[model samples]
Target: MIRKLFLIASLLAPLPAGAEPLANKLFAAEKSPSTQESMPIGTYAKGCAAGNVELPETGPTWQAMRLSRNRNFGQPTLVQFLEDLSVTATKIGWKGLYIGDMGQPRGGPMNSGHASHQIGLDADIWMLKPASLTLSRKEREKISSVAVRSADQRSVTKYYSPQHAALLKAAASDPRVDRIFVAAAVKIAMCKTAKASDTKWLQKIRPIYGHDTHFHVRLKCPAGASLCQTQKPSVSDLSKGGNGCDETLAYWVSDAYLNPPKPKPSKKPAKPRPPVKSARTYVLADLPSQCAAVLSSR
Candidate 1:
């Protein structure tokens, strides 16, 4: 019996060094194990599933699906959001407005599957344009000029239009917005417009370093996919002083306001030649004539 037990133990022993294990055999198994999984966005799932919408997939996925050329209207939720905003703007008497630069739809090189615009959920509404109105090139240029000229560097609140303020307020009130990146000046103007109750939404607008050209609206990624990678909302460090919005507004005024003072180029001095050492003196009696001749030759 002892001999039989020894034989069984030897058969079950680990393989020797440099030897391969059997392909289908298990050497050892753990009694307990741990696994990791990511949590899906429940809020997004609720909205998308109820709306009968699939999150827009652009780039390679679109190409693989062979629907590459379809005009992406944008994510259904985003379109709905825009519609709500547009209706509000119209009621308030804003005109000549249109969405701009939705970027490439899913499956284009420009989109690369991660573009905010490609998801059909993000749109750039031109602040300079009025709702349902079109502008000639010259007229558009004039509006740009007015935006620059009218902006005040000392006090942004003084120059911000009531129309612009209302638009921001409407966007902030939306529940789906993950965050909004606006010019510092615009953010400052928003703080003034925000009442105590509106502070919650006002806080969602994060002031980034360079948004003078346009505001960037980022939406929360819907559930069940890996694409949404936005960070959690935190109070903006830029808004700490209560003047960051004003500072940002002032900074966006125009070329006159935005441009920093040019630093003067520094001049370099001419390099000097290193000093030459004096020749060592040696008496003819202190060295052989041949050595002296060799040294002289060297």
Candidate 2:
């Protein structure tokens, strides 16, 4: 009994001096929220959240996927937006939304999966139209979202449907959303149906690599939210009031990007640079000062 007690005590001992712990590990260990007011602190990719709330694993209009990951937590604004969107899904012929990771309980950098979800304002919604919202937790783990993009990455497959487009439109139209990310092929398909006079909603849907089976939604900082930060150059300014269906979109699926030419031979090979430190490398000192408090709060 004494030997077992000594081993347990050693495991609980504090880190040695001059050692800094990874912020992701620190946040992931927090299974419950902090005892503080709800607030998303710092930038989306590099911050923490206080008083984050967890979405019920199963709801009438939505089911949070990957239950064992314990990442269904988000700010109150995000939770409401998701619930509202799920109801919208029913109107669009889908049973409900199958939500993915939202954030860690305290909302800091994660050890895996994402970097932006650290703020509790970002979420991944599966592209698969759920036939049933009553999926058992075990089944949710085994089931996978259907891929909408073709393997060539130049166009969407038969899996991309009108209902999926409608769902994307509704989410982007929401006032709470700042931007959404989808596969470039999906956006190209969306562009073809957009009317010249009414395509402003498409501006919020940005194209990035991957996301063939899911779309990522990011919310704007809530009103009166303290310590929250937004990216520069508003989406409208970047889009110039036009739907994002221009040369930029074309370039994403172009051969120059999808099938790039080989680099020319060089006289000397370039030296490898040290890895840049980011969310995955950030220590407590690298994040917002208040993040330390959030991580330590009971």
Candidate 3:
């Protein structure tokens, strides 16, 4: 029957593909190169260029994993940042540098899987654990460093080793780092340290909460690349207890100005009833006795 044939065809139909891959569609929106001379380099410009530098492939523990070579700053830059950080730590006599997550293209949007990890400019470095420190069962339980199954998830903790602190300092000191996330207390500590070190880049470092378990370093996007989605610092909501540290920070809840005012509770008027029509009247003598009796009873 036609119904059977239709059912078979429906079952055989191919499934629709998901959204277009980012690697293929990126840079399609960029305008053609201009003939004008390049702009002069500034402090932020230096930071952007340093952030875009290509990194090596080998890591201390993990191998470099790239999504696409054609994609700008995909895996190479991330690996380079790691290698540079490791090298910096070694120069300072610190050891045990391990990268947590990098270069995850299939992860979900921001706030999900390592979204920062998607663009290849972001990385999560694990907290350093020294071999000399003896940890009781309870103390070990307090330290957070779990094995992540996917390349997108990151662990959160409240503790940081001195070595970890050094690595964070090095990254924040680098001109390539646009922003770094650590603990609130650690940020305050870094501010004091930065003031003592006479390094202006450390003065530029901003601290946030809940990143004590790992370090999240984000780099500025490179020239002519649309894959990077670096956000400029905005005004913070000081009213909500968030330190509005950045300039031009706007109150996120400013939409209260546009919201409709609450309606006042008022008493409702009673509904009117329909007017009833009087029954047709007839002279008592002209009406039939039964009908007249019924009407009289009504």
Candidate 4:
């Protein structure tokens, strides 16, 4: 019958509406935070933040860069930590700090760059100690952070200064900070000058790729934040009680690491499987279930 054929065709046709939109797109559309109580749900790279507060575009000692991204929002604790760190910058003889991306208005996967900022606890503090905090929004967009690591990634550049080390020391030493990510060379440079007996804080400064321009700061889950997940502690048995200054650290800066040999061609075609999704391709269902409630909230 005609009705049967129509039903069969309907069943065969693709239903775009049934396929949910990506979490990044949904979250990116949100220009404000949820009304729910503050909470960082799930892991850093695969979660959503509720009840985030915006850091003022311009502060007395800091200016949030890339204002047009509208990513100056974070949890209350994160905002406070940045404010305090800006003051710390002044004490270290720097003018102040040039803060970078904190999180989206309602923390979730962003349209581009950074996976860990999905939660409200991570922020990027620029290496360039602010030339001036009074810069206009347009200037903030064009002004670039200084690269402290060399192009070869083996050493720190001339731009690296004593005050820069002081800032890192202060930030890593903070109790509120869970960890800080910087270029391996920067960590190596810091390792060279650190007191032999006082390298405990250095343990928190992790070596990672492409953080020469700015350091990424991740804060601890605040007290009684039941929904928050704490990142696993660093496992570096590289030195005396693992301060990460041993030969193991050198591997990251070696030529082998910078230019590894290309893999040999496979004899057989690789089996296709679901690729690991990153922030760029995350969907609503890929995030925590409570995120639905958060997104739906007024």
* Per-candidate local distance difference test: 0.42, 0.89, 0.41, 0.88
Q: What's model 1's TM-score?
A: 0.48
Candidate 1 regions off by >4 Å?
1-73, 107-118, 129-159, 224-226, 234-298
Candidate maximizing lDDT: 2
lDDT of 1 at 20: 31
Q: Write the per-residue lDDT of candidate 2 for residues 1-298, one digit (tens) a residue.
A: 6764664344345667657678888889889998889999999999999999999998999999999899999999999999999999999888899999899999999999887898889999999889888999999999999999999999999999999999999999998999999999999999998777778889899999979999999999999887999866444464467677889899999999999999999999899999898888888778988887786666
Ranking by TM-score, best first?
A: 2, 4, 1, 3
The runs of at least 3 residues in candidate 3 whose Cα sits more than 4 Å from the true structure, single-residue gaps closed, are: 1-74, 105-112, 130-162, 196-199, 235-298
The total of clashing pairs for model 4 equals 0
lDDT of 4 by residue, 1-298 (tens): 6765664444344547747567899889989998888998888999989999999998888889999998999999999999999999999888789999999988999988888898899999999977787899888889899899999999999889999999999999999998999999999999999998789889899999979899999999999888899988865753647887878789999878899989999999989998887888877777888887777667
Residues 1-298 of candidate 3 have per-residue lDDT tens digits of 6765664444334435543222212112211211222111112211111122233333443222222321123334455667777767666555445444543222111222332343346666655543323334344334445321112222223444455556676787787676776544455444444444254454334554345556667766546444334566642433443442332121111233225478787699668888642111112222222211211111
What's each prediction's TM-score?
0.48, 0.92, 0.46, 0.91
What value does the lDDT take at residue 196 in candidate 4?
86
Q: What is the C-alpha RMSD of each candidate to the true structure, in Å?
A: 24.8, 4.4, 25.6, 6.4
lDDT of 1 by residue, 218-263 (tens): 5666555453344555655535533234444445554665676786
